[model samples]
Target: MFETLSALFFAHVLADYVFQTAKMVQTKDRFGSMALHTITVYLCAVVALGSIAWQIAVLAGLHLAIDALKVLWVKTRDDDGIKPYLADQVAHFITIAAIAAVAPTLWADGIWTKDLAQGGLLDISAWAPKMMLLTAGAIYTTRAGGFAVGKLMTPFAAGAPTESLPKGGMMIGILERGLIFLMFLAGQPAGIGFLIAAKSVLRFDAASKNEKAEYVIIGTLASFSWAIAIAIFTLAINNGLNDAPLLEIMAAKD
Candidate 1:
């Protein structure tokens, strides 16, 4: 577990660096904004530790809460503007948590080994390439999805007033995609933790009723879809890796 986690950490760091670079390139003079965003996110994460069930419930709850607050705050403050749609953010968290919850079973089934952890962190260093590939894949997939969605919405946005959109739509897009990339690189739980922290800071502003409702709907769908996807992916990865015999071994012990 430790070895896997270590690899995950490195992958996460690398992916985050790349994502940050991309953001800088897109926004130009965005240093202050990025610094503030990172600091705020870290602070929120620190505060979240005080919540009950810090490992499980708190982590997931925090993610949900932040997104909920963000939508609510935005709508309330900018009633005339388009609100930040949080459907994707909510869905990503749900998917990550559901998958992570079941990951232990995969290990038990020998999809990977707890022994992998025993190998000492250095022993697994060779796996960095594979991990990097996974990280890259996640980043690509998330950016692709966002671009596709943006393109689809572009046509309708032409006649629509920009002010009709939420004040932080672009920021939300960057953060949402960044969080997803981080989660894929670092593992789901960590990713969720980061998002919860970021979202908390965003919630200082309140949302309007319609905005809140929209957020609720988007969050609800995203969470549900994520849960389903994680389960499917976990199972698929396990089977594809040919761990049935290991699972049988585990089953017999049980």
Candidate 2:
């Protein structure tokens, strides 16, 4: 059941975060756009959940239904804020959990497993589960975390200056979180301090008494906090999945 849940959640993260595009999100209220997003979800679920065609279909169908309702609710309320985003995500999670509960066999007969048998891309080694978990963690930390933190900062961003470089903030957050994730996995947690210090120094001005400064501080803190939490949690899970400690696992690779 745990394995099934992990695979399903991985698939969900990929479908909802990594694969979802800005265009898909922007026009999701339209039937064609919504259906396209659902197809992406279905394809991801198929790869993760394997030959359980009926179960995968159910999961995708539920996802589409939930998304549709969320779009309608948001449109009616004219609110595309953090609250609705969080609620929609929670609903999708519940749907995934329900599917995992009923499809425990998926872990054993999963598509990845079949691929391994066919001399395909994946190898069913001891690291296989950890690899999947790490992949999911990476995506969540960089992509999903960006959306979450952006929503969180929405209220504070009103009337703020718009003289910054285009897409600069988004790219910075992505790279920051990605680096933090790697540093933690490499057992070099202290490197984060240097990264933070560098960022602060680069952003520091002769004076710090303005909305722009405060805004940057808030976004930076939120991004750092989210990345740190995810990295720690991922490391804990990775430890549980292995007989060796994290350091020892790294040593073996050396």
Candidate 3:
């Protein structure tokens, strides 16, 4: 039953992705187009029982929350709005910090590890697939940061002041990186999925070439950074020095 259910869920997810991609190709006003596109996707999910029928219903719930936040933000705020950006950033930071703080304890307590061990798959020495997913999220963030830098450079060359370029790029990079890091720490695939969806929406509406380039650069760099960090952290943890202090510092209250 689980296998059949998982397969059906995967099919629904694939169809939703295709439908959104097609809509993006046809729509000129990227922002408006994506807003509508996501709404349609949500409608489909509701009608098809995509959320309730899925094994990972929690993920679906998280995705819904993320999408709801995105819709509210885009509708109420300007493209370069500061308040919305800050609010999102703060939320991301808090989420990541919380995850980093509690994950080690959770692992030690045998909550997730015990269940896997029962299936004869326990390996405390080895990072799980879910951990790999978190690492991927971090890498995506680093890539986004790099992309943002590139985009800002173009505007600088076109006579936009150096100050303005950096400021604009930094703002976007902060939001991107913060969200990526947070989602990774939270292990919320739904939240990450929403971020991916938001990117598609932005792509449809992105006007300035430099802006797009910057976003891409930042994303690329974020991904790279995440990969490197994960590798280093995995090594550190395996060596028996879990680096609890560093983790605590990172997770410390802002």
Candidate 4:
């Protein structure tokens, strides 16, 4: 069940973030484009959940409604902000959770309790269960985390004239956090420093001035801090869930 849910969630991350192009994203409000996108979502769900036609239909239906609502919401917005992004994810998660809980075979064993623990390291929570945690972190640190950082910088940004970024800062923040999170998972702290250095160099021309420099520092730190915190928590949770059992330890000796 845990593995199944992880597959489903990862499918979502793949479809929504990794596979969906910027062009697709920009045009989702129109019926034809959205229909194409919805088919992709359905295909993802089916691939993850298997050949169950009804289950695929349900997931696809909910995903479409949720995404359509989001497109309309964004279309009406003055400029993009965090709440809608978070809310959209929240609604999708709820739908996923419901399906995970109510679906036939999946519903019965969805929980990741000790009963599912077996098969030495292969069956360990670290290998199977933690995949979900990592995938979820990847998904959240994208637009969702970007939105959070935006909110954090609101006070600093208030009344200040907006500086239009040639490359959208939203996407940049997503990549930054996602990379940092992966670095933490890989146990490579130095990569994060390198990332910061690279980013600073990129922005130095604009941020060399006093006011811009201060804002850049604050935003950069805040983004780094959020990513680092999530990485730490993810590692910690994976460790806890994957703690070695006496049985597994004994088996290791054999």
Using TM-score, give the best candidate's number: 2
- Local distance difference test, per candidate? 0.38, 0.77, 0.41, 0.66
**Global local distance difference test of model 1:** 0.38
How high is each candidate's TM-score?
Answer: 0.30, 0.80, 0.35, 0.62
In model 2, the Cα lDDT at residue 251 comes to 14
1-254 in candidate 2: lDDT tens per residue?
55566667788888888888889999999989999888988888777655556888888899999999889888999888877887888898798778877877676666556455584446463455566778988888898889988988999886244637898879989999999999888878789899999998876761164757778888889899989887876675566455446433231121
Candidate order by TM-score, highest to lowest? Answer: 2, 4, 3, 1
* Model 4 clashing residue pairs (backbone): none
Span of ten consecutive residues with least summed lDDT in model 4: 245-254
Off by over 4 Å in 1: 1-132, 151-168, 188-206, 209-254
Candidate 3 lDDT over 158-192, as tens digits, reads 43324435566456555655665664344442465
Q: How many residue pairs clash in each candidate?
A: 12, 0, 29, 0
Off by over 4 Å in 3: 1-63, 80-86, 96-117, 120-125, 129-134, 146-241, 247-254
Can you give the lDDT of residue 70 in candidate 2? 87
Candidate 4 has a TM-score of 0.62
**Residue range with the least summed lDDT across 10 consecutive positions in model 3:** 1-10
- lDDT-better candidate, 1 vs 3: 3
Model 1 agreement with the true structure over 162-197: per-residue lDDT tens digits: 333574554455456555544543435345555655
Rank order (by lDDT, best first): 2, 4, 3, 1
What's model 1's TM-score? 0.30
So what's the TM-score on candidate 3?
0.35
